[model samples]
Structures are given as structure tokens and as C-alpha cells.
Target: MKKMIILFSALLVLSASGNQTKAEQKADVSNISSANINQTIEILSTSNADKSLVEKGVKHAANLWRASDGTEEEFTAFCKENFITDQAEKELVFEKISRNIEIITGHFNKITLDLLEPVHLNTFEQHPIDNAFGAYSVDSHWMNDFYQNKIAFIIALNFPAFSLGEKEANAKNWTRQEWAYARLGDYFTARVPAELLQEVGKMAANTDVYIMDYNIYVGHLTDAKGNRFFPEDKVLLSHWNLRDELKANYANKNDGLEKQKMIYQVMQRIISQEIPEKVINKGDVEWDPYTNMVYQNGKTIDATPEPNERYQQILNNFHANKAMDAYYTDQNTFIKRQYDGAKEISAEATEKIFTDFMRSEETVKVGKLIQKRLGRKLQPFDIWYDGFKARSGMDESKLDAQTRELYPNAAALEANLPNLLVKLGYDEERAQWLGDHIAVDPARGSGHAWGGAAKGQKAHLRTRIGAKGMDYKGYNIAVHEFGHNVEQTISLYDVDNFVMNGVPNTAFTEALAFIFQKRDMLLLGITDDSPQKDALKKLDLFWSAYEIMGVSVLDIRMWKWLYANPEADAAQLRDATMQIAKEVWNEFYAPVYGVKDQTILAIYSHMLNSPLYLSNYAFGNVIEFQLEEQLKGKSFPAEVDRIFKQGRLTPNQWMVEATGNDLSAQPLLKAAKEALEELK
Candidate 1:
């Protein structure tokens, strides 16, 4: 989901000042020394506090106390005064801080939601001014303000950030309040300057715009023999729609192979930056992706390939993230911050999980099964083979017709939200409450769930609706996004504390989304009567996890590559990306598909826009399968409500609490094995 804007606006703030380089942003040196830390700890030793916590907190505050913040003496005095030793008073202070931060973050989220409407929603024609406004961050300097006013030092001295290891080792014994305090500690762990944060925000906005408007008028595409394969008005956004279209053609009896080949060619051209510039987002020209040729009214014309803009965007994102490395001493690189700090899972462990799972014998078994079903040799695009789902056998045009009749526009979808909830076994009153809290909007791009930050603000569900109405693809994605909205609502509204009002990470939300997405047919009153339905579901989940895991590994390795070659230009980075994509594919995918040197794994749009996020979808599939198993023979709505309300526990902790098992791929692998046996 594109929920980053809410995060950016809520956590970071803007400074009303001039642009500053990285060195200039880090000009304020720490004034506190080891002597100051020792002195402060000694002064606080008389209080009945944990000595270990005191030492950690004092040292943490010392490191962040800048010369501009105060003198060493003043730092010592601030720690002495602000540090709470009494349990009752400390709890009271924590509660107050939680309330204040909720107010601050909630309002900032609202501001960003409003400012981004023109760009995010299909409300009007987008202008450069709209993008500028959308990119303007209001909270970029809020952290600086906090430090300047001594609030940051107060937080640091009280609730020092815990390492991921510490949290995992000790959190089982901690209370809910202590866990909330730990989350609070995470906020001030870094000190990125306002200007750098703003630049990051602008880059994020620019990439969002780029990814959103990247539409391909597939109807205008012509094959080498000048044959049209798609309808005249069918436009698709890359690479989501393109991939879906490829999947949809699996059920197509007429020209399905040719269409899949055409789409595959289009994807390769996009990844290699060989697509004609004039053909993108424009239907005035006919292009043959296989020949890399452009035509106007039956006349071939010379066309320049896109100038490595895709790779350039990735370079921009890398530089923007790399600029903050100096400030994050604890997690020096963006990779560390993303995995250890944000995801609360180490990158090493995540990679091993994916690679080990991808190498499993079940992968080859599943691939053989798919190939048997298709009665053809496996192609690179078969990675998205969709025949396992009930909907895969049905005509997509029929599903589109049904959806369009049901939901003619955003308003129609909004009106039917409560009913959709009720279909999932929610009672009328509860469904109304959820539907009331979620507001649907017309999306300019693929729909996403932008969750509400505060209780009063409504969560916005941006859904793409064609001029005719909501198509089947849009409805399916809408349901998936709806799952995110539901999780966002339950976690926020039912959690015990405001500080804990969310999932542990995006993966948890994605798990819920997958759960809802797989139920799209059920929601439409279409049930799979096959006795093999359960096994089919397992195989589907396994195949999907198998596909995305490779993509996620590629994403992680590419970031690592960029960090190693920080000075590489766009073309050089593109070459590196291509190399890494092939390496990953050959290692994990080639044995199954009997294909090598296929770079289709690199065709994911997330590689350019959402960094380090592909892993969540793979992990989410794992979580989704486990959760589905847990929900069997239980009250579906009750189980979902109860599990999600646990809210923001550490990943494994949350999994254990919800499913009586830790997060692992073993469950899925075993289930898929059993499924293969049954299907065979």
C-alpha cells in the first residue's frame, strides 16, 4: 500500500529555512561527554530506578544532546530533572506524552491527506503546483523543534530506544505499558535534519507521481504482423495491470498465448528501458513491443527509447536515503533501519527465510503441476499462473460486468461497504461502525488504503473506477485495500493504548489484505464447490509466496548493491540491477521453470517506488496462510477482531499470541506438501 505519506507527515516535520547539505545538517555536534553521562547517572543513582535503564537512558540522551541544545552541565541538569524514578509518575507522564503525540501525528496525517488529494485522487487535472504542494512536508522540522526545546532530551532520558534483540529477549515478560514505552522510545532514535527530510519527502512524492501516471494504452499495441490483440479502449497501468492482464489470459482460449507473449515482451522492454518514449501514457501511436518499433497511422517512425528514467528514480531514492546515513549512528544504512529498526526483523534472517523456502523441493513439484495443467513448457510469465483460483476459470469480462452493475462509481462502493462487511459475518451494527469510519475516494492510480491516524478522522480508501464503473480488477484490489482499512480501523480503535494503535509492521496489515483478497469470489456470492478447494487455496498461496520471495530478495540485494556503488550512474545501476535480477532468478527460479537468464523477476514496480517493501507481501502470504488455518471452524469475524485488536506487538510475539505459533515458513511449506499429495 502507498501508506508512506501518512508515515512521512506523522513522524517528520518541515523547517522554515534554506536548503542545507548533509554536512551542514549535521553541524550541531554533541556537547555531552562520558564524564557528563557518568555524572548524570551518579546523580540519579539515589532514586529507586533500574541502574541498567538509567545508564542506557543517560548515555542515549548524552549522545543526542547537541552544543546548540545546551552545555554539558545543562544536559546533566535536564536529565536529572526530567528522568522519572517513581512508577506512578512515570506512567502518568507516558500517558500524557501519548495523548499529545497522537494529537500531533493525527493532525499532520490529516494535513498530508488533504494536500495530496489532487495528486492521489481523480479529482482534477494535476498541475506542477499540485505536486509541489503535495511534496511540501509540514512535520519535517518537528524533530528539530523538539530537540531545540529540550523535549527530545526529555524523551531520550526517560524512554531510551531498545535494540531489536533486547525487545525480543525481554518483551514477553513486559507489560502492555512497557511495550508502549518501547515504541515511544523508537521515535527520537535518529536526528535527521529538516532539509534532508524534506528532500526525502519530495523524492517520495515525485516517485509516487511517476509510478501513478505510468499508464500503458495496451489497446494501441500491435504485434509484428500489425495485428491488434487488445480492445481499443483498454488502458492499463504498469506493472500491476499488466501482470493481472497476463494472469487473466490464462483462462483465455482465443489468442491467449499470443497476448501473453506480447505482454511479456512489453514487460521486458520496460525493465530494459527499451520502450518507446512516445508510446507511454499515449494512445496516439501504435507500438510493437517485440520489434521495439513505433507506428503512426500504419507508417513506421523512428522512436527514442526512454532515457533510463526508471533506473534514475531508483538512484534518486538511494541518494536521498543515503544522505541520512550519518545521522543514524545506531543503524547507519537505510537497509539496517528498514529491517532491524522498522521491520523489527533482521535483513540476514529475512533473506535466509526467502532463499531457503525458494529452494524447497515443493517449488519444483508445484511448477511441474502448473506445467501439466497448462500442457505447455513453462514461460517466464507463468510465475503469475492464476489457474489455482476459482475466478481464474471464469470469464473476467463477466466478473467485470457484475462489478460494474454492482458498483457504478465511488459512491456506489461507499454505499455497499457495510454490506460487504456483513458478508464477512460481521453483524449489522458492527459493519455500520466500520463502514462509517472508512471514506471511499476515486483514485487516479491503483487503489490504496490510507489509514486514519486518529479516532475522529476517517480512513480513506482510494479506489480506481473507470468511466463505465468499477471493473473486476478494481473491485478485487478494492477488497484487498478494504482489508487494510479494516485492520487499520480495528487496531487503532480497539487497542489498549494510543501508542500501540497499529500493526507491528506493514506485513501484518498485508496479511489481512491477502485474507480479504482471496475471499473476493465469496464476497460476490460465488462459492467454489470443488472438494479440492482447501488444497487449491494452499497451492495458490504457496505459488504466490514463491513468486514474490524472489522479487523481494532481488530488491534487498539491489539496495545493497547501490550502497556498495554509491557513485554509479543510472546506466551502471541498471546494469547492476539486471545482473542481480538474473542471479536471483537463476538460483531460485530457473531449476523450476527450466529457464535461465530471465529478468522478469525485476519487472515489479515496487523496485522503483517502494524500497524494501516487496518482502512484506511474501511474508504477508505466510502470515495469511497461518491466519487462515487458525480461523478454520471458528467464528471468522470474532477471530479477526480479537486477533487484530492485540495491536503492535513484536512480529513473532503477535503471531504467537494470535496463532499459538511463531512466524515461520515451515507451516506453509508443510501445508503445500500435503496439498500437492492430495491434488496428485
Candidate 2:
């Protein structure tokens, strides 16, 4: 039987929304100092070693790899040398987490330390020729999905116990979180095995070709609303569709394209219909089934604030459909544009570039040409991850001692925000207005911003800072992250339950945050309208949207595949995902590079950590493009800031205020088309 969704993952987050009083619990730990913090923990977690020792002897013993050039087996042996039995077992994943801490210790504790080197994370372009077991490699997207599924599974499995409280409830019904978890878990468990099969089929084909419809399973099944997912009794389902001129294995041009468009249209229309309902009833879901265990639903899904129910429902419905429909409707146009313009760089030219880059004497660097061949890299797939360290214009060691200097944690960001805003080009008045309106605080945990957890009110802004340290290399992320905090702070603080929080949906928030983030360069002593204004804005927008649109495509397809299968197992899910990934890359991505069946995009961690978040990046950039028009040359409009201060307003209304327009693909496509068309 299906279980309840408990939102345990949500509760696991000790957010300000949590019932516990954080102020009483959170002492000024910075006073203890990062040096003391690191040393104290080392003494506790590891001991009897020189704290400052560069190489491991005692303290570093727990996570140490062999001093010699050891193989993976030898490294494990070295780990056993010093770690307590319990600690040693965790060396695999824990060590990676510790790497973050190790760098922090190196800083003595300051987030402002310059620890990370810039990195290039274009894994999507790399996996084509990688000899590592083809698409079946766990290092591919499948691995990321596994962890994500694991989390959902745990939530589904545990929520029943949580809601029961061992006393009140039946102790064996689906709670809200458990129910949601089971729904998502059911999707993943079924998908994993299905995807595995798909991967085997691709590997068996032997030719480096893509099966575009692989992520999509062709099956006869009724959708949630009881409509047939495929018109035929048997569905020709897969994630990839030949949009615009995106070529696929299917030979029929007209019939295939028409059929593909119909599938896309139905999805677009279904989402247009279902999403509104889901959003309205989101907080409310019925639950009754008890399997190994069960929980009960508490909040009614789709319930809205009484004052704004009607308008908000309209807004909710609009927001639900707008982001996906934009792409779904205009997918053909994007494909056509790329198809007509994609340079026919043959397989020979492509491979030659890959070879030339590899054969170069320099081994420390990896460029896009070489990077595209390897699957699995950390994500956001941006330029922040550069091979070489960023230009170290400042001293790293001294920065660590100055917590008060580098946005001293999140709370300090709000405290020091006015000065930073001034430095970043905001006027004194506007800067002060920000300080007055928003409450900045450290993230209870992780990378997201919106609706505060405190006081059950949408009238407060919470700026969460989760940066381990604001190192020079990581400052870009810091600024971008703060942009999210700032937007989330403003939008939520200014509004009540009527408008409450959130724009259209998550995407609107992302776009707004991005608007602030793209200003990072400007804030970093280079004002947006400075000497390079024209070129700077163009470069930023082009790259930002260019990167996110491709991501959005993958995200949209993933959900569809999940919805279609409804019962795929882990291996099948893996194969199905890989096949879909290959197809999407080939159809949408390959032509541009004269490469086929590339699965580099599978490395996105969001594919595991947060479903559908990638789509928000694309939508956010589109919304940003439109908002940019309204914000142009305004010099920090107070009214604009006021609007932003109202957290979580619907995207369309925000657009109406910010740009006198509605949510449409026109702005996003216009920006993208204009930018790409002008590309050499």
C-alpha cells in the first residue's frame, strides 16, 4: 500500500520555521574562534598529533591516505592505520565532507579564507568517449539519483513512525511527508531498474548513438487524471523528442515531429491543468494505505489563504504552468534555431579537438573539449570551477582571523549589509532600507532561500548564510547566495498571508535571486554600469540563460519519465535515465557540437538532492531578463525594492510591476536568441 509523505526531510532541517528557539540555542560560537573550534574537534575526533603538521601522523590519521603512491586498496589500508574502527568505516563519504572541514581548519575557521581554486565543471560535454563502462557507470547520473532516492525512501519508510508519535495517531497510516516520500520513492525504485535495462541496450548497440526516447518508456498507462499517457494502446514513450530540427533515429520527419509535438503538447496542457490543482492542493493529500509501516496526512493539500484564495488560485495555476509551458511550447522554435545554425562540425573535427587537448603537454588543466568526455562533476555547470586558482590579490591567512570583516556569518551579512551594498553600488538610502526590512541569519542548513520558518508569518525576511567560509575563490558563490537571501528576505517580509510568500513558484524566487547574483561582478569593485557595462551584461545573461535552458530540458523530461513509469525498479530506472539522457543530449545537445549521445548533464546533484530545481534556474533567468528591463538605469528604485520586499508574490504580478508584462517565453527566448544570434 502507498504511504504518507511526512516531510521528515523538511523537519530534519532545523530551520527558523522549526518550533525550537534558535536564539536560546545558538550561542556566539565565533567567540570561541575557528582555531579553537578546529583544535577542539581534532582532539575529540583525532588526537596526539601536531595540529599544524602539513602531513598526517596523528591528528590527520583518521582520514589519511597512504603517504606513498598507493592504489585504492592501499589508501584504505593507510586509513585503517590511524582511524578508530568506527571512524574508518566512514572514510569514503565522510572524507569528502571532511575535505570541507580540513580547508576550514587551514583557515583557522574563517569562511573568508581563500581555499578553493577555480574549477571548470562542464561534465555534460565530456562523457561521450569516456572508457569507464559507458553509460552504465555508477559515476554517471545514476549514482546521484541513488542518494536522492535513498533520502526519499528513508522519508517514506520513517514518516509512518514519526506521525504516530507512539501514542496519538494510529501509528500506521501515511503521514503527509511519508505519503509524498512514497510517491517519489515509488517513482525512483521503479525507475532504477528500468533505466539499467535501457543502459544495457545502449551499450549493446556498440555504436556511440543515442536512443532519444530512452528515458521515456512506451507503455499503455492512465495518467493521474485517468487520461491515457499515450494515445495508442501501446505508448512509444521516451524522454527525447525531436524538437524544431533536432534529429533523431526515427526516420519519419513529418509524422514523427507531429507526434512528438502532440506528446509535448499534451504534457504541456496536462501540467497546465494538473499543476494548478497540485499547487492548490499541495499542502493537502489524502493518505490511508499502510505497508511495512504508514503515517497520516495533517495539512490539507491545495489549501490557500482565505483572503486571497480566488486570485491566488488563479496565480497558483498560472505559476504552475508558466515555467514548463514556456519551454514545452517553444521547444520546437529553440530546436529549429539551433538546428539551422548548428555548425556541421563533423565527428572528425570533434574528435580532433578532443585529441589535441589531451595531447597537450599541460596536464594541470582541463578545458571544455576534454572535460566533456568524463561523466560526473559537481554542478551548476558554471565557470566558477576553474582549473587554476583565482588570482590571489589578497593574503589568505590574515583573512581567517577577521570574522567581523567578511560578512561575519549570515547575521553579520544583514548587520553589515548597508556598507557592503554601498560598496556594491547601492545608494545609502536604499541600503538602509534593506537593513530595515530584512533579517539575515545563518541557514539552519543547505543552499536555498525563501519563506522564513519563524512566527508562522510571511511578513519577515530571513537571510540564511551557509558558506563554510567566504574565501576569495568562493566569493562568487557567496555573493550569488546572498542575492538569494536578499530576495527571499525582501519578498517574504513585506507581504502578509494574502499575497504571502513566493512568486508563481520556486522559479520566480530563483530568477529574482539570480538578478542579484549576476551583479556579483559589479559588487566586486566593478559596478554594473562601469566602463565595461554593455559587454558585461551581455556576457553574463548569454551564459546564464544558455547554461540553464539545457538543464531545464533535462529536468522536464525526467519528471515525465517518472510519471509515465510509476513502478520502475532501480536498475531499470538507471537504464531508462541513461537512455533518456543520451537521447536528450543527442537531439538537443549533440548537433551543436557534432557529438551524439553525450550524457554529461546527468551529473547534476539536483537530479538527486532536489527534484525540479533546475527548471527554476532557467525560469529564474527568464524572469530576470524581463525584470532587468524594468530595473534598467533606475538607480535603486525604492518602489522596486518595496515590491521585492514582498516575498513570494506571483511571478506574473511581479512581472506586471517590474516590467509591465506577463510571464512569457518571449523575454527569455528574446534574450537567448539575441545573444546566440550575435555569437560570432
Candidate 3:
């Protein structure tokens, strides 16, 4: 999820063109026959008697279409072939599938041909088959992004979870009935990617068309060309999956005033647990609570933590880091004192300085003047380091032309990257290996990530470099993204999980990337051991933690408000969220004046699109601080490289195993504040 971004950033403020009129084609659904009902039941009842034979038996038994190749034509054909025109017959058939457990269960088992994997904790059983279901009738990008890769991804989900010792299967679980439910219970989606209301309105309004039978629908989203728009990485999906995350995360005053930790605890508990059941209405009995953690079933969570000592430490570290972060916010009166530098400048002057930076030009007064305007937005880094100064040692004041003009993109400048990574921590071999992977291209949309040969388990990874209008800041961003691409390329391709890959969480990967990004100064051969350079490093940590931590707060508070008043409209929700961020800004950064428009922070689309993800930014920085503390002089490259190689464990688990300390915010905050105090 390093490429994690919302489809709605510009929609918030900067309205860029995204008016996609969905390829105005409607889809239809089907009717279940008695043969269909009986066949579905048989498949669910059976097991892996003959893997190959079962495939032949499946189609012979029921008229099921393999969405294995979910193309627009295939999807459309699926809809039309199965669609029932007679309302009475359609209801009768759908009722049979819905009412009979065996029918639904059998169908679910059959659909496993498309999804259902071993390590994956999700299974969107019966999806609403429509124009959106990977249809490539009019487009071919679907071949690369969807059909071939999409089906491969589905199969990837089937990759068996790597268990430690045990190897045998059939001897464990109880019944086929249990397996049927287990297969369907793990994953979820709201049927279609479109708004639930929109889908419902369409379904109800149009009786002529059937978008396939609703009874066998598995909730999955697809784009016009029929590609899964979701992030491909499973670990990233596990941490911040939009649909799955928000469904359980809801907790506002109206529904419940549960704290985030409590909610997070519930979420953690159910990692392998069954779904929690809540009463739909006063008359309804409690639906069904999730069973319990697979790692710990039928026992009290307090009974005994799982046997993984390393993971326990990770949990401990997570708490410690969060506790330390809390301490930094509450520690002293220094936080109350204003930066007189900011107060010295007027709002107009501050805006002018900021505008100059935004316009990609030189600014003599960025530190004081810009800080006042940006306020909490301004971490200590914005104080002195200019993007222009960062890349080109020549002063921004002296360089009259743009940064690209001064430092042209040439074979000469390409080496600046390898030299940069080596300075940070990479060895000669690793640096050259990574440097060679560097690649550049004009990007579509706004952001970029590791693409080309550099993405996922393919020995050759092209470190995809996307450049947005040439500027010093853009160049710096390109470098930062480059570090991320390198880390991702190396980790995904070089690490063990080529078949089962990617970091268990985006945070750990981000920490590695940030480690590279933070080296911008040191990487460029600027070795100022002075208080300013030291201050710059410390400032970078503080600023990194500050930005992400603030985002976490916003996410936490918004979710709080959202669940509190389930009835609130979008306007009410937006307004209340704005107020929450403003107050948090005032508290965390009251010292910095001219900090109007705190609500701008609320503009971060991640708050709406990516639930509970921002905290990782702060969390990653804290981990980096601790990792850096241990690796300061003692074989940092070796230590960090080994740590990055262990991909599958949770962040906390990884940290505990690598470093003695639990995930605590103190190391980063303490080290940073100490550096700040020294500067004073």
C-alpha cells in the first residue's frame, strides 16, 4: 500500500478531471433451477477427492460460469445467459439458493475456483456480476491489470499460509459443514463498488434486467474494464482495507462511545476470529459474535498470550511507542511557548514565502515566515532546509532559474542516487544493485510507486520513477519515492515470499523507505555535523512523527464521531471533523501563530478513504528511531538488511525480534526533543 492513495483527493479541494461516466452499459442476473440447487449442494458436501475430476463434476452438476477470466464480455455474457425474465420464476429460484444452506454453501465451494486461498483471511463469495466485473469488451488494459493478473491474484490468495511445524491436513478440522461457512465468512464487501444506495436504487427501479442472481452474489468491486481497484498487496489490505476496516470500526456516540483502543482490540481479537454479531433491531437476537482468534480458540485472551514470544514483544513495543508519543505531547511547558520567529512575520508575508516554495522558487525567509503560516503543518525541518539547497548546494537566492535547469536530468545526475543510498546505509554491492534499478517515466495521475520490473517477486524490478512537473521539491519527492521503490523491489524480489510476498504491514516498508528519504541531505554529500545538520535529522523525525500522528488523531476522532452519530449527514460529519482537527492543531502546536485553516489538514483524503492507516506514518518513524539507535555505528546496513528480509511477521513482531524494546514512541520523541533542547 505504499502507493496507497484515495480516488478523491482532488474532489476535496483541487478539482482535477475525474468525471468518469461509467461505460453506460447495464448488466443482468440469473435464476436458479432445481438442478442448479442440487448441484450446488453436492459440491459443498464434497471435499478434495479428485482435484481435477471435481472441476469436471462442478460444471456438469450446475450451470456455473467461471469468472476466472472476469472480462466485460464474459461478465456480460454471464449476466445475460443466467438472467431470468419472469419475476415469479426468478424469485422462486433465488429463494431456493438463499433459503437452502446447502445450495448457497455448494455454490460458495464452487466459486472457490475464482477466489478462496489458504493464507488469505477473506472470501467475497458471490459477487454482483455486472459491467464492472472485470469486463474488457472495449479495453485491453484489463488484460494486464485484470483478467490475466486478476485471475493470478485470485490464485495467489489460495497460497497456503506458511505454518511453523504442522504439515498434515484432513486430520484436524471437524466437518464439511464447518468448512463451507469458514470459506465464506472470512472475506466481505458491499456487493458492488458503487454506493450501496445507487446499486439498490438501480436494482429496485429496473425489473427488466437481472444483474445476476442476488442470492449467490459475492460482494466485490470492479472498474469499467473489469479490474479489482483494490491494492494488490495482502498485508497492506489486512492493515487498512477500506471496506472491511470501516464496517467493524464504526463507533460514535449514537451507536457507541467506545474508545479507539477498545475497537482496535476487538479488531485484533477477531484477526482469525468469527464475525461479531450485533442485534439488527430490538426484536432480533444477537446475530453472531466472531468465534475467537484461530491462534487462540476456546480460551480466554487473558488465559495465556499466544506462544509466539517475539510477537508479544511487538505488541509491548506498540504500546510503549504510543505511550511515549503521549508523553511527548504532555511533557512540558515548552510546547506552550510560541516560536517568536513565526510571530515576527505577518500572515501576508508568511503566505508569500509559502507561495514561493509552492511555485518552486527561492525564498530567503522560508523558515520563520513559512512556519508561521503552516503552523502545525510546519515541523522543525521547514525551518532551514530548502528543497533547492538540498539538491543543488547553490543557494536558492543565487539560482534565478528553476532547479531542473541547474541540475538537468542526465547520466551524470543519475549517479547522485546510488551515491546517496550508499551514504545512508547501503553497501557498495547493494547500492549498485539498487542504483541500477532506478527508472524514470512520465506518470499518469498524481503519485507513483515501485512499478515495472521492481514490483512483486519478479527477479527483475524496474524501480518506477514518476516525475510531476519539474521542480526541486518534485525532484526530492522523486528521490523519496525512489528509496521506497528500491526497498520494495529488493524486499519483494529478493525476500522469501515470491509465491507469498510483501511486508506484513505498509508501516515497516515505509520506515525503510523513510530511512532512505531522510538521507536526502547526507546522501548528497552534505556532511554538516554542526548543530543545524544534527537538528535537521532530529527535526525530520519529529516532523515525520508529527504529520502521521496528527493524521492518526484525525482518523481516530472522525471514526469516533462517525459511530457516535450514525445518523449524521455528510455535511455534519465534515464540519465536526474539521472542528476536531482545528482543536488538535491548537493543542499540539499553539506556539506557532498565524496557523489559520487548520481544517486543511482535514482535507487529507486518507481520512475518508483509508481507515486507520495514518497512524503507521508516526508508528514507522518511531520504529526507525529505535532501529537507528541500535544500528548507529554497528553494521547498520547488515542489521537493517536482515530485518527487512523477514517479511511476513507483524510490525510489532518484527521489532521485538530485531530490537529488545517494544514499539514505544519514546526513543524517537526523546532523542528528537533532546536534540531540540540542545539547539535551544
- The lowest-lDDT stretch of 10 consecutive residues in candidate 2 is 1-10
Largest lDDT belongs to which candidate? 1
TM values, all candidates:
0.98, 0.41, 0.45
lDDT of 1 at 57: 92
Off by over 4 Å in 2: 1-414, 423-430, 436-446, 453-468, 496-499, 527-536, 645-650, 672-680
**Collision pairs in model 1:** 12-139, 13-139, 13-140, 13-141, 14-139, 14-140, 14-141
Error of 3 at 66 (Å): 16
Sort by TM-score, best first: what order?
A: 1, 3, 2
Model 2 whole-model lDDT (C-alpha atoms): 0.35
* lDDT of every predicted structure (CA atoms): 0.87, 0.35, 0.36
- After superposition, the stretches of candidate 3 with alpha carbons farther than 4 Å from their true spots are 4-394, 397-416, 423-429, 444-446, 451-469, 563-570, 591-597, 608-612
lDDT of 1 by residue, 1-680 (tens): 73753232333211122222553355355778877789889999889999998998998888787777778888888887899999999899998988888888788888988999999898788899999999888667787788888888888889998888999998689899888888888788877777777676688788889989889999999988889999999999999999999999999988888999999999999999999899888999999998898999889999999899999988888877777767767687788878886678889999999999999999999999999999999999999999999998899999999999999999999999999999999999999999999999989988799998877988888878999999999999999999999998998899998878888778889999999999999989999999999999999999999999999999999999998987899999989999999999999999999989989988998887788889889889999999999999999899999999987788999999999999999999999999999997
2 versus 3: better lDDT goes to:
3
Residue 86 lDDT, candidate 2, scale 0-100: 40
Following a full C-alpha superposition, what root-mean-square deviation does model 3 have from the true structure?
Answer: 24.3
lDDT of 2 by residue, 422-481 (tens): 765678887776656544433211223333322222112222232343333234444555
- Candidate 2 residue 160 C-alpha distance from true site, Å: 31
* lDDT per residue (tens digit) for residues 1-680 in model 3: 25421111111111011112321222222233555544443443354334332332233212222334453344334333443335465435433422342333223322321221111111123333532332211111221232233321221122111111111132134232222222221111001112311232222212101111101001122222333222232111212221122222221222211222222333332221222222110111211122322112322232222233212222222221122111112111111101101011122332232222222211212234345433324432132223212332343212213435534543334555566667766777887876776644322212235322213111111121213123333344455566566656555556542312244345666676666666654544455555466555665565546545655665565555554654454445545766886775565433443344354344333432234455546556767777777777678668866766654343444577668666566566566556555655
